[model samples]
Target: MPISSPRPPPLLMNLSLRSADRVSYCADMASKLAMDKRLDDFVMILESNGSDLSVLVGLLDARMVSAGICGLICEGRVGEVVRVFRLVEGLGIGAFELCDELVKAVLGLELRRLVEEGELGEVEVEVEVRRVRERLKRQVVRSVEHGGVEPTAGFIRR
Candidate 1:
């Protein structure tokens, strides 16, 4: 007699299917928001992830992957962004878009910093952006044990 594999419990199967449905719904909506370039709304939908990174991964679409990257970058989550990039960059166009958005975001952030801090120079901003570009180009990264990007210590979240 051939051995048969045990089936999953009905309750477990139903729960798993429901969870997948939820992730799909969130992913579709998040992709739409990303296409619309609604970064804040994209991030808002992210809070619905309930701290589950997998749900967040489903929310990423290559063409608009930058939307997710930008939103999280604004949230100061460099490590998380890198982790996601590692998973999805091979799907695209995504790596290029991610780099472009990273530059734009860094410039925006630097400009905002200049406003409050009142003494930053363009050269400094340029250097920082260049550093980030070089790092990404190298695919070299280091994440903090506490779930943040290393070296900069500016990985803040609001």
Candidate 2:
């Protein structure tokens, strides 16, 4: 007899929101959706995915009003959400930290663009660079304190 492979899991559809307002609206809809008996089945399916339930919490934070709605949608089934939250909290913090890095990258790119376009004189460029560096240093320090990440030697070197 041939060995059989396990079937693949079902794909979950990502709820799409066109705008921030839509997030709130959808969350309300999710609350209504939760009242259905099917919700329990959905929760079971979600749990099987091994996804960090914290992602749902992060989504709730991302759409503040939606948090309660999400809880309701889960039919007050919080165990999976709690488990996912613990798993995803660190990743969420890292992602939050990366937002600052993204701002720095954008600023650096803009500065480079200005130089390439001859829109900034060398002296102005130097001054702007210094200013940006100082601002970044202050921001990095604040981020380190806020995020509880030690300033890395590489970051200090830069």
Index of the highest-lDDT prediction: 1
How well does candidate 1 match the true structure in TM-score terms?
A: 0.34
Candidate 1 Cα errors over 4 Å, as ranges = 1-17, 67-158
How displaced is residue 127 in candidate 1, in Å?
Answer: 15
lDDT, residue 11, model 2 = 25
lDDT for model 1 comes to 0.56
Query: Mind giving the per-residue lDDT tens digits that candidate 2 earns over 30-132?
Result: 3344334233432343243343334332333233223432433234333332333333343443322212243344445554665788754753655557668
Question: How high a TM-score does candidate 2 get?
Answer: 0.21
What's the TM-score of every candidate structure? 0.34, 0.21
- lDDT tens digits, residues 1-158, model 1? 99999999854664555666767766666677755655456555655666454555644674565555566666655444444444344333243443345546664685576567764454356556766887864443545444555644554566
